[model samples]
Target: MRLEQQPLSQVPEKAYHLPAGTAAAHGYDLEVTPESAGWGYSGLRVVTLAAAEEHAFSTGDDEVVVVPLSGAVSVEADGSHLDLAGRADVFAGPTDFAYLPPGTTATLLSERGGRFALCTARTDRHLPVRYGAAADVPVELRGAGRSSRQVRNFGTPDHLDAGAIIACEVITPDGNWSSYPAHKHDEASATESELEEIYYFEIAAGPQGQPGLGFFRTSSSPGHPIEITEEVHDRDVVLVPFGWHGPAVAAPGHAMYYLNVMAGPPHPAAEAQGGRAWLISDHPDQTWIRSTWADEQVDPRLTGERS
Candidate 1:
């Protein structure tokens, strides 16, 4: 069955509508409505924190990913303090991504605060908040035979066996491709795998103020062909329901960025079903991962009026 899809371009550029009185008198950030209809009850949206506000952000009944699109911020969890300021200056390092698992509480302070986009998953799927540092964590190169690169994989280098929900953030360099060839893990077969996916895109303008855009093509089936050509800016997203989604496309002008939030019906949930898999077929010419380490990651120069 074809699912209801929403494209960022098709969606009118609407300002976030925060309920009146929601903003506290003191340093408090406003939350934007994460309105999307693709994955069943799962919630996805963008929450922006202001500079003047030093809100103590936390989560409840859901797994959340705290990603700073731009600017410096401080994140504390499990009695550990991690500073995300000037990380880019440190060898083109990335902004830290904090995954808040169920029942975990934390506080965020934005000294020179700007805005942060938080993607939360609402379901029985529980992902304990994990804080992984790109500078500290060792990246393992996976995917052989034309596909090769490092995956955070979590603090533990192990494959998911319980159809557990996962949140992964990768830094794709300029003119380089991530996600590589088309692959699907919709089946819950043994200790190997089972899961569905939702790709949320966040991009900064490429070099010379060139807009960063992501390319995506859906399988040519009876369902629908969902394509993204919106010249995505920061805080833009494209939803995938059923199809072979690949080549998390990036243009030569800018390095494309995205966070993947995934969850699916595990085999245990489907007692009658043999396995869990709803992956559609993919087109030809869409196969490649990594072989070379590529070039250095140039930071995206944020320009053209910071919204």
Candidate 2:
């Protein structure tokens, strides 16, 4: 199936902030193209399907990873089918995912209603389609105290065979902070690897199913200029091409979950010298805050269990 494309300039004036349903297209609840982001590499599309319903689409010139956010899904591409055992929710630990290379047509089917995320990147190179098991995903707990957060490294350089794309998920507990110290990867150097990033957030609802809220911020870097500070809700998106980003604060009443999609030129030399990984330059003014983690304990709510 061909995707109904939209012009990039047609994106809302608030370039960084995209409310739920604002970027909808075809069967997707949120569709963000490279053109829409005004960047060259990273993009994302989120789709919600009903019981026994299926959605089909082509990858075109981009490669995508099919990740089930709330339910199970079967992904078929290039005559290969991968059935994913997904978690009940983002807070439910890790979920299996499938990767589709460029020029491949794929279909996603769910027996019961569910939501899925297609984390994508424009690429000229075509890789092999494959499956990623949740059992192999690395869960890392970073920072301490209120700065604590859980990271599921399901699609990182050392974990998957993605060409340029590097994706992951982060879970921050209520009243806690993640992405602290304001980091930047906008410069291409031995210390930093320039990359474009997309942040898709989902605030956990309250006990009575009340909606939740969180805050996101992105400030201007040395030469790169960008300024964004907004209260984010379910399905909200933030695009970061060049800037210092951080402190995605989950409000006291709600836990926050965000899917991070990143892609850019690979630095083989830097990898051989150091290590192939996402490198960031933290804001010097607040860099000292990291030391305080030694005095605080991680939030007890970070129980890495899936049901």
RMSD of each: 8.9, 4.3
**TM-scores of all candidate predictions against the true structure:** 0.60, 0.92
In model 2, the Cα lDDT at residue 24 comes to: 91
Q: Local distance difference test, per candidate?
A: 0.46, 0.85
How far off is model 2, as Cα RMSD?
Answer: 4.3
Residue 156 CA error for candidate 1 (Å)?
8.4
- lDDT, candidate 2, 1-307, per-residue tens: 1132344334443777888888898768999987778777788999998998999999998989999999999888989999998889988888999999999999999988699999998776677899999999888888888888999989888787776788999999999999998899987786788778999999999999999999999888988767779899988998877789998999988999999999876655544422235888999988999888878877788855321
Model 1 sits at a Cα RMSD from the real structure of 8.9
Candidate 2 clashing pairs? none
Which whole-number lDDT from 0 to 100 does residue 67 have in model 2? 93
Off by over 4 Å in 1: 1-35, 41-43, 56-58, 75-86, 89-91, 94-97, 103-107, 123-131, 136-163, 190-194, 204-206, 220-234, 267-307
Among these predicted structures, which one has the highest lDDT? 2
